[model samples]
Every structure is written in structure tokens, then in C-alpha cells.
Target: MLSRAARPALRAGASLQTRAVLPSSANFATLREIEGRLKSIKNIEKITNTMKIVASTKLNRAQRAMQDSRVYGKTSNGVFESAETKPVEAENKKKLVVVCSSDKGLCGGIHSGLSRYIRREALENPNFDLVILGEKAKSQLQRTNAKDIVLSFAGVGKDIPTFADAQAIADQIVLLPNEYSHIEIVYNKFINATSYEPAVVEAFSEEAIAASANFSAFEVDEELLSNLREYALANSLYWALTEGHACEISARRNAMDNASKNAGEMINKYQILFNRTRQAVITGELVEIITGATASEDM
Candidate 1:
């Protein structure tokens, strides 16, 4: 038989106990959520780190391939330079644009840069057709310039591009029914590890080569000119592919490195938050326990 005043105090203490217990349950749930977030961020860091390592390993080989291909391409195109070759521009002459990009992503904006270049060019000259290399560029251009795409290649840039691959692609281009007056290859030109730009390498037709200002200086066999033109196209394609591959690798390494750094920072932030939350929860538990003990003793 408690007095009315004592009953009110007991009810108040019981209400405090209930509120304290509820918060502990909520605290546990919050702690679990923080732990899950921390684990997810850690996993992301691991993936980005692994990607950075792989890109770093591939960069050296890709650079070597690009250098060799560049030299080969220069040598192949020297004859055109010496002859001062120029593309024949006729009203009815068709132009072909070949875009060299990669199949993989996570390489930053390399692919998008190429697509944007082509789109800008298309806006200026809608008469030209496109030949896309790699899925990334193809997928992007398909949305805007689908009608202009005459040919496309996939499974490119998986490794260092081989001369044979270029030859095969050239063969397909040559087999097309329409004879293009000029063939332009668009590729990412690596200026530095972190910088690249879309560039074009021109491949002239035999007619254009024959019309060169200095064509009379060299006595080229009439039959061999066609073969020379084809060989030069292949060389140019190889150069573009190799250079683009190197750029892609470098861009991927940089992207992954940045991702890893950001993930690390996030992990640190989350870790601090988790520790503080845990401490706060512990402190709350301690306060609740002390309050319960004091309440019981007073009773």
C-alpha cells in the first residue's frame, strides 16, 4: 500500500526505464548499419586498388606497343608526305570516318571524348559515314548517329593491337561497295599520362595519291600504288589502335587511383563516425544502468 506521491514517482521511474531500453535497441540497429557501410566501403577500396595494379602493369607494354606502332606508321606515311598527297574533294565523293575506342569502361572520359568529337563533326558535315571501333563508342554514337554508321568492330583493345587486326579491319573497309575519297581515323592521342586528345590521321585513296604535287618525282609502279595505298591504311589503323589503347590504360589507372583515394577517405570518415556512435551507445548504456541502480536503491 504505497502513498499517492510514491506511486507517481514509481511510474515516472518506470517510464524513464522504458525510454532508455528503447534507445539501446535502436542504438544496436544503428551500429549494425554503420558496420555494414564500413565493410562496403572497404570492399570498394579493394576493387579499385586491384584495378589500379592491373592498369599499372599493362601500361608499360601498351606504351611500348604505341611507340613502335607510331614509328611504323610514320615510315609508312612518309611516301605520302614526300609526294604531298591530298584528298580529292568532289561533290559526289564519299568520306569515311573511323573512330578508334575501347570496349572497356572505367577509363574516364576517353570514349566519350571521341564520341563528342564525332558528333560535332557530324553536325558540320552530315554527308560522311562512320566506322566505329569498340563497343563504348559504338553504343554512344548509335543513339545519335545510327544512320551514319556503316561498319563497327568489337573485341578491340583487349590487348595490344596487332598489325593483323588492322589488316583485317582494312580489308573489310576496302570491300565496301562505295569508294571513299578520303578516310579519316579518329583516335585518342596521348600527350601525357593524364592528358589525351582526339586526333585524326588521313588515309588517301589511290586517286588522291596519284594527284599529289610531287607524285612525278618518284617513279612508282602503276600496279604497286594500289597495294601501297592498302598497306599504308593498315599501318595507320595499327598506329591509331595502339595509341588509343595506351591512352585507355593510362586513363584507367588514373581513374582507379582516384577512386581508391576517395574510398580511403570515405572509410576513414565512416570509421570515425562508427567509433563515436559506439562510444555514445556505451555511454548511454552506462547512464541507464546507473540510473536504474540508483532508482532501486532509493526505493
Candidate 2:
């Protein structure tokens, strides 16, 4: 015969055994949900890793183009450096800023950094007109300074920039009716694999170049001044575009790498949770079976 405490404990076990079916089904559903989420995270990781590889490959070519363009740009500007050229100052003249950014995104803060620099310049001196070379910068600056935009280009930064592309853009800038005291080509400077900063390449007006302090040292035909200014503009623009492309590629690689790492961590955590939950469901079913057998024996 069973004691009073033993009788109550046996009755409670029988009740728990009766309700076990629903709990088991619920636990199984939970496991299924965890599995689905884990699969999705894994897929995301694969995509990010692939993007990282592509960006890394493009980075090398972009850096090489940047180095070559830098040599051409420096050689063109050598005369101005020696002469200590400066922008011709006049009360009526406005400065021109050529902003170089890309249409594509997901490369971290490359676009925002250029926009921020433009904003800062607007605050310090509002006497500048913008000639943007990419949709990214044009879209950003339009929201705040639409009226200041003189021209904007599309289809920029699709691949490694070419000298012909720079020459075409410079031709358009030269055709603008409004005269500028000097031109500033703003772009991202590649510092390292993980670092970049906004920088400017100066392009002087024909008048500014002619007014250079030591201009008399070099004798040249008067007609060549216009040609020299245009050539120098193209060279500077080519340099800016190539350097900006490298910076964008490097930033994208780093961003994708970080994303892949985070997804991997989530997958690991979910996998452990899934295993523990499966074991728990199995243990609960065993307990229920044992309890039912004990009750039958008691009866």
C-alpha cells in the first residue's frame, strides 16, 4: 500500500504525462524555426565573402592606375609648383569645385566623407560653384545647395577611369560661361587598406597661370596658355578619379569582411541553441513514457 504523500506524487506524474504531447509538438516547432534562421544566416555569410573577394581583386588594379595617374598629374603641375602659382583674386570671381564620387554605394563612408567636406567648405566660404562628376555627390549636394550646382555627370566610376574620360569632362568644364578664379578637384585620398581621407587637387585658371609670380622665367607662345590649362585640368581630374576608385574598393572589402564575420558568429550561437533544444525535447518524451509505465504498474 502507498503512503498519502506517495499517492499524490503518483497522481501528479500521471497528469503531466497526459499533457506531454502538446509540449513536445511546441518544442519541435521551435527547433524548426531555429534551423530556418541558421540557414539564412549562412547564405548571407557566403554572399558577403564573395563580395569581399571581388573588391580585393579590383583594389589592386585601382591602386596601380592611381600611381600612374599621379605621375602624369605631378609632371603637368611641376611648372606651377616651381612658379608658386596662386589663384587670381578678384571680388567678382567665384571658385569652382569639381567633386569626384561614385554612383555605387555599400563602400562605407566614402561618399558621405566627400559630402561632409563640401558642407564644411560651404560654411566657411559660400562663393563656390559645384561641378559634380558622379551621381552620389550630385544627389547629396542638391538637397542643400542645388542652386550652386552648375553641371553634373553620370556613369562615373563604373571601372578604372581612363585619360579620355578625364579629357572629355575637362572640355565641358572649360565651356562653362561663368569664369572661375581657380578649380578644386575634391576626391578621397587612399591612405591604407583600412584608411582614407578627403583631399583636393588644384587646377588654376589660364589667367591665374599667366599671373604666376615667376611666369617670366619660362618663355612660351601666348596661344599655348589655354592648351596648357586644359591639359593640366584633365591630368588633375584623372588622378583624382583613380585615387577615389582605389579608396572605394578598399573600403568595400573591409565592410564585406566585417559583415561575414558577424554572420558567422550568429550561426555558431544558433547551432548550439538548436542542439540543446533537440536534446531537451527528447529527454522530456522519455520522462513522460517512464511516468506512464510507472502509473500502469501501480494500478
List ranges where model 1 is wrong by over 4 Å.
1-17
Cα deviation of 190, candidate 2, in Å: 1.5
Tens digits of lDDT, candidate 1, 97-155: 99999899999999999999999998888889999999999999999999999999999
Point to the candidate with the largest lDDT. Answer: 1
Name the 10 consecutive residues with the lowest summed lDDT in model 1: 15-24
How far does residue 104 in candidate 1 sit from its true spot (Å)?
0.3
Each model's RMSD to truth, in Å? 2.1, 3.8
- Give the whole-model CA lDDT for all candidates, comma-separated: 0.93, 0.92
Best by TM-score: 1
**C-alpha lDDT (0 to 100) for residue 259 of candidate 1:** 99
Report how far off residue 107 is in candidate 2 (Å): 1.3
